[model samples]
Target: MSLRYTFINVLVSIALLSSCSTPKGITYMQGMFEEMPQEIIQQSRITVQPDDKLSIVVSSKDPELAEVFNLAVARHQVGQSITNNNNMQQTALFTVSPSGFINYPVIGEIYIAGLNRQEVAQLIQKELISQNLLKDPVVTVEFMNTTVSVLGDVSHPGEYPIDRDDLNVIQAISKAGDLNITGLRENVLVVRKKDEKNIAYRLDLTNAQSLFQSPAFYLRQNDIVYVEPNNMKKRQSTVNGNTVQTPSLWISIISLLTTISVLVFK
Candidate 1:
């Protein structure tokens, strides 16, 4: 084949290969319409896990009586006045141990892992009533550490607190400062733990319709959302602080060599 034809083929190949990510890939919810029916997607429930910090509050009609079953939170000096203590009232945060149990004031150590926030509160309330400690105890439980990790190719990659229990993948991405321009919008990875093993789910944000059907649609506490970098961004990244040639670089090098040979041989 002629050198001119070879060079043309080389240039065309580079141009085609360079188009790794297109404008369509960058656009989110492509082909979506205003008349499209919305799908009902249920948010995942966050279960209490080991090392989870929980705030449990016990309340009843008789304030003095309820205080007996509650742990005294030392907000200030122990000898502080009642008014000062009231102003600084704070529930003592309970940290679930590795064994999935918390040392309660009266019930001693009780397993709480794998239980939801409401179920945990109900368990405590039942214990109080069963022990005849209180006629009817009202217990409230809230997760003090409902955070999700957003890492890789994101504007802000770190642990973000999820105030709402019904958080989803889209919300998690928004909290991470949204995916950067370099992030691979089509391939986002969600890492979750189950049965002491890690399970990863891939989500395509470019297709909003399919995203609803994704298993990672609802984000669980401590779930990790990893946005991988696209080809362009991967090429820009350095290896060990040293510049490395990506596939495009090698292709460019070959094209240059082929063109040089064509001119030298012509």
Candidate 2:
């Protein structure tokens, strides 16, 4: 074969191989058998933290008796004109103090941080019974402003509210429209704040065992999940697209090959 034809064949082969190459560690929960081990499966719960807003409601057999224990709804005029004004009522939200205490209607200050929603409800129920305020009180507690932020290499990165108590890392990612193709699944980062200190944990989505064993698997309120971009993606972000696998590099190589072909023929 001629030298020019040999060189052209090699370039075409290289381009074909590069185009066929697929990224590794993209599939999640790999190496799973028919049934997962019971020990590996863990249940996670959401715990209340400082600065969390809570909505606590107390109910009893008698509606009138329960009304006093619950926070009264705040009402405000909606329209600017007096004739067209409408009264709008909104649920009163209780912000947990930095010291983990919330001022209840009659019970005053109650420390509730680190407790789950059910535990908070039980505590309030006990308080009402102990104070002889309600004979059969049923208290319900819910997180008002708890959310987790998902950023970097996600389809739709944003802050997602934790609607349920047991929102896991997988679910949180799904909420953000899952990670993009260029996301680095091997080293997904979860940043959590506890005791005024920020702690970071890395989880490998490719390994089910490692992901399940991670403490940050169950995301907490205000947690941040960051999916770092792969090496190729990082390179593409640069002005020059500095990588042999990049499209720009491939274009330059094709241009060089075309020039060599013309010179060889001429």
Candidate 3:
């Protein structure tokens, strides 16, 4: 074959091979089934932890008698309107001690760490009714500092309050304005705390159907969700798109090499 024809053929073959190489990790969830396998994960309720702020409010038909059981909220009167305080249920801010106890107005020190919100409220209510302090007492418990953090490739990354007890990774991301387009859906990270130690897990969310089966699907209080950037964002592109290098520049290099080879062979 003539040098021009042979060079053109070689260039075409190189272009085809490069195209194949570029698709190695260019796509996510390439062959996922529509219906994912169902795995049973025991949904655990969020228990109280050390350093958590709690607000306990006790009430009954008589507001005067109930006043003794509850503490007072402290703050500066913002023109006697409202104060910039968190909405934990405590009339006065009560910090859970390291020993897992809080000293109440009349109940004294009550060990509450590791118990769910309902359990704590029930315990307090029982104590009051048994002691004849109040009849048909109603107790309310609030986790004032229950929050989760969203970071990395999300649209809005920050700590968000968990109004409800149960939260999932998907909802947590949604609270932070969802993940950006460049985020790697298949490599979402969840960092959780257990026994005062942090543990991390890698979750694949590209196949939306399987997100429910992930171990990290249900997030705990103070858990952090970090969505990493996809390979496209890591790439350095010039007009073509993001990535290591532009395809046109690579093609030019191949062309120069081919020209050199043709000259030597000729």
Q: Whose lDDT is greatest here?
A: 2
- Model 2 per-residue lDDT at 191: 95
After superposition, the stretches of candidate 1 with alpha carbons farther than 4 Å from their true spots are 1-22, 30-43, 77-85, 238-266
- lDDT by residue for model 2 (1-266), tens: 37777777788888888888886688998866546556654558898888999988888999998988777665554477423323443458899999999999878999998899999999999989999999999988889999999999999999999999989999999999999999999999999988789999999998887788788888889999999998878888787666766677896888799678869866
**For candidate 3, what is the TM-score?**
0.74
Q: Write the per-residue lDDT of candidate 3 for residues 1-266, one digit (tens) a residue.
A: 38766777888797888778743332444446565566645665678888999988989999888989888756556685866565632377678998899988777899998898999999999889888989977999988999999999899999999888777787888899877878878888999888778899888875555566667787778888998887677563335465335687778878887787677766
| Top candidate, metric TM-score | 2
If scored against the real structure, what TM-score would every candidate get?
A: 0.73, 0.82, 0.74
lDDT of each structure?
0.82, 0.86, 0.80
Q: By lDDT, is 2 or 3 better?
A: 2
- Candidate 1 or 3, higher lDDT? 1
Candidate 1 structure quality by residue, lDDT tens digits, 61-161? 98888887667686565555445746687777899998899999877898999898889999999998998888878998999988999999988899999
Rank order (by TM-score, best first):
2, 3, 1
Instruction: Estimate the TM-score for candidate 1.
Output: 0.73
| Model 1 residue pairs with clashes | none
